[model samples]
Target: MTTQHRTIAFIGAGNMTQSIVGGMVASGYPADAIFVSNPSPGKLEKIAAELGVHTSQDNAEVANKADVIVLAVKPQLMADVCAALREQVAHLADKLIVTIAAGIRISKYRQYLGDDIRMIRVMPNTPSLVGKGMSGLVADDRVDDSDKSFITTAFDGVGATLWVSDEDELDILGAVAGSGPAYFFEFMASLQKAAVALGFDRDKARQMVQQTALGAAEMAIHSELELEDLRKQVTSKGGSTAKGIEQYQAYDIDKISADAVKAAVKRNQEMAELF
Candidate 1:
């Protein structure tokens, strides 16, 4: 189905959902066709006022009116939310269900919603709030090409997307891209702290790190060279950049980073087990 013809319902009105809705609105999706539901009126009203989408407190209301339902609720609340809409969802065969809550598998969704429901799990990073999200999508067997394509197109407004045939990769992506932003934040925080200790003002230090990060990311995105090659291009033999690299190596940055990501993967796996 075409995007313009689809009535998409967001089951929650959190930051990620707001970002997706904002991106959709910016990308020219019909605001009136988008429906957002939240138990609290504050967020729903804000989304409606800001994005011009329809809002409701009832999950079944949005499910009944939408052709596509996005489960944007927190991972812990997913089971109860699904149970609330189980009857309404069971009756809607034409609807497509897409979830952004990490760690919850498609089989788990099937168990909650039903085996016949078409569902897709997506791991999207926090950068999506700024219209630069990287999402890994995995669809159940019941989701056809048309459904997948439409869902992909809808998320494309927020940022880049990749369709993964393997469900395991989606969980793995939760560690990588999903939690990747936190790693960068930690790194930048260190940079800012160091700059402050070196006598730079906090705001100036922040601006420096933020701008450098933005420029570096843009370069990585647009440059033809590989990331390591880009790093090599900036680091001359026995130069200041090389000295910094030596310190990083001395601190075992690579191993530390890998361990951190692995820890996140373990936590994600644990969530799957918990939920």
Candidate 2:
């Protein structure tokens, strides 16, 4: 089915679901074709009012009407959510199941939903809230090209979408693009703190750090140069920028970053086991 004609339902009305819905509406996807449900009416009411989409409190009622169902609940809550919908499993046979929850693997979903379901696992970060998110997707072998195309189009509304050959790669990507925003935020926060220590007011420090970060990101996006080349362009030999780079190198920043990403990947694997 054409993406525009597909009725999409988000099973949870959380921030990520809202972000995706907002992006779709902004991108001119028909809001009327979108349906959202949550146990609580607060978020559903707000989204329906703001975005002109259908809202409901019943998962099966929402799922029954969708060509695509986004499983957007928390990882820990996923099993219970799927179990509740067991009665609807037969009806959902032909629907495309897309999950944004982390850690839980496709095998677990097969156990809960059914082995024959066409499923896709997506890992999207918090940046999706602002339409700058990156999502990694991996689908079951049963998924067809048409379904993949539709899923890509749906997620592309929020940001970029990458299709991986294996679920393990998606987990690694979760460690990078998924947890990456927090890593950048932590660095930005540290810079803000240092600016404050250097006598700038807290608000000024924040503004400086944020704008600098934004500018740097914009530059990287627009430039064809490799990141190392871009850094070299900023760091004239023996200059202040070079000195700052030297300090980062002295502190083994590369190793710190590598280890941090490794830790995140490890935790993702651990969560899969836990769930």
Candidate 3:
């Protein structure tokens, strides 16, 4: 088996895997180069038809044919998949493993493979399906500069990438940036309903909330100032915006957000220890 190129083989053909595969294909990877495999032949065929990539039901075939093998299967299946391909992974002296499953550590990779195995653990969010996600990447000690650079380039196809050395910080980023989009989306949904309650048409309400959310995000993304500064910029002395800020503060929304992220990160750490 060869592990020589960006010819990625995803073990799971689910949505997250497809999000990555679609992003790679859209980023100029040849269809012939990518491969996908699953336990179900029908599922593999479906993904193959959609991406025009090589597909197979045999995980071993994917192990043999692919260079960069992605451990995209669920956490519960991780051990089985790793143990199944332990030899193949060991044979991947040159290939790099990139994992997207949350809370799984590099040590777990070594546990499933060997202590000296080369691997990268990545945490990406659901929004990646639309190419607007952010991912946190951490490389094991065995991974070299070239390996690190390739991962950055590969995940960069989706949205943004943040490289971290401390794997624990990954949990912090995961609970917030990785899971943060859903919260904002839910807030937008609520705001849309609020607009409609004020007699706006459904479409108009949706447009108002959606565009406001997008514009706020764009403003933050393009700004040089910190979030505090950005928030202040929208508030005037004794204005409606200030009054809204006072209300949010009175309700302790800031503390609520902080507590939420802290709780989430804690849950992740606990899961990691158990998993």
In terms of TM-score, which candidate is strongest? 2
Higher-ranked by lDDT: 1 or 3: 1
Candidate 3 shows a clash count of 0
Task: Report how far off residue 144 is in candidate 2 (Å).
Answer: 1.5
Clashes of each: 0, 0, 0
lDDT of each: 0.88, 0.91, 0.83
How much lDDT does candidate 2 score?
A: 0.91
Give stretches of model 2 more than 4 Å off. none
Question: TM-score, each model?
Answer: 0.94, 0.97, 0.91
The list of candidate 3 runs beyond 4 A from truth reads 1-5, 87-90, 196-203
lDDT for each residue of candidate 1 in 51-162, tens digit (9 for 90 to 100): 8999999999988889999999999999999988887654655688999998888889888887778888888898888888999999878888888888788789889999
RMSD of 1: 1.6
TM-score of the candidate numbered 3?
Answer: 0.91
lDDT ranking of the models: 2, 1, 3
Candidate with better lDDT, 1 vs 2? 2
Candidate 3: worst-modelled 10 consecutive residues by lDDT = 1-10
Clashing pairs in 1: none
